[model samples]
Each structure stands twice: as C-alpha cells, then as structure tokens.
Target: RSDRNNAIRSPTSIDMDHNDQDEVPTASLGTWIFLVVVAAVSFWSQATVTEERFVPALNVIANIFNIPDDIAGATLMAAGASSPELFSSFVALFITHSSLGLGT
Candidate 1:
C-alpha cells in the first residue's frame, strides 16, 4: 500500500527523451461494484441493531485489510471496537495498582 516516487536523475540513458509519464490503472467495474457492496455491508453491520450481521462484516474487513484467518482478525477487531471499555479498564487497573488487563 505504499507508493514510492523518486525525482533524482540517473546517469544512464540521459540522451533519450525520458518523458517519464506514469500510468495508474484503476480497479475494474466489477471490482469497484464488489468493493462498494462489501463496504456497504461492513457499515450496515457495525451496529447493535443488526446484531447478527456484524460477524460477516468484520470478516470482510479482515480480508480487505489483507489479514489471514478471519476469526482471529475478527476477534481482534471486536476487542478494538470497544475502545472506551479498554481505556476504562486500563485506568481502573492503574488506579487500583493491578496488573490486570495486561495479558493478551
């Protein structure tokens, strides 16, 4: 997901007309439609109202993120979804001087 562009000149083949125009091809129509559908599903399920739907949504996100093992990634994502709870747990442990909530 990184794009590297260098502006330095090379010592070789300088005599040629180095136009240096780059082409960036985009995703095809099918791919775009597929991704749009997937994104719509992901957002639709990121809510508690449709409680039974988020699992597939998270799985799709994991795949789009190039992660292996949908279940494991989904678990990690679920844990991350409750950021406030995590922060609260951390503060409570700190005030109580406990090593709790530190174990993965």
Candidate 2:
C-alpha cells in the first residue's frame, strides 16, 4: 500500500544536505597539536626504555642461556612484536566471545 511504502525508509533516504555537513564537528588545531606532541613523547620514551633497559636485559638473558646475541634479540623482538596480536586474540576469544582476532 502507498501508506506502508511512505512509512518505510531506505538507507539512501537519510539527509545528505550541505548545511548539515557544515554543522558536523571536528577536532580543533590545538587538540591536534597536543595529540602530535603526546605521540612524539610516547615514541621518545619507548626508544629510551629500549636503549637503556631492554638491550641490557637482553644481553643478560643471552649470557644466562648461552645463546648468541643475534638469536636472542631476534627471538625476543619477534615475541614482543606479536604480543599485542596474541593478547588481542585471547581477549576476543574469551572476553568478547569472538574468533575475529584469530582469523586476522
């Protein structure tokens, strides 16, 4: 019926007006600059920590295990790089009850 057809709305029926687009919000310049500074500081700290602590710890571990420096470093770096993905998979499987992360 015409009444039912009028009542139903398709995805394309949503407003696409220029005035509405202009009213959409965005982050200010100051907020963007602050985020850049925070990111720079985060990268700097990570580099410093790796240089000062991680390398020395790796050397000690290599010495203890009688493993070559290159092998130990490579193994640890691979584990470190993959840890976020591994943990995300566990979280997706257990907490979120999804297998999406594992497939990724």
**What are the per-model numbers of colliding residue pairs?**
0, 0
Clashing pairs in 1: none
Residues 13-89 of candidate 1: C-alpha lDDT, one tens digit per residue: 45354655544567899999999999998887666533666556666777787767756555756676787778877
Q: Model 1 off-target regions past 4 Å?
A: 1-21, 48-104
**Local distance difference test values of all predictions, in order:** 0.67, 0.84
Residue 63, model 2: lDDT of 93
Tell me the spans in candidate 2 whose CA falls farther than 4 Å from its real position: 1-20, 83-104
Record all residue pairs in model 2 with backbone atoms less than 3 Å apart, i.e. clashing.
none
User: Tens-digit lDDT track for model 2 on 10-104?
Assistant: 64663432257677899999999999999999999999998999889878988999999889999977787788999988899889999776676
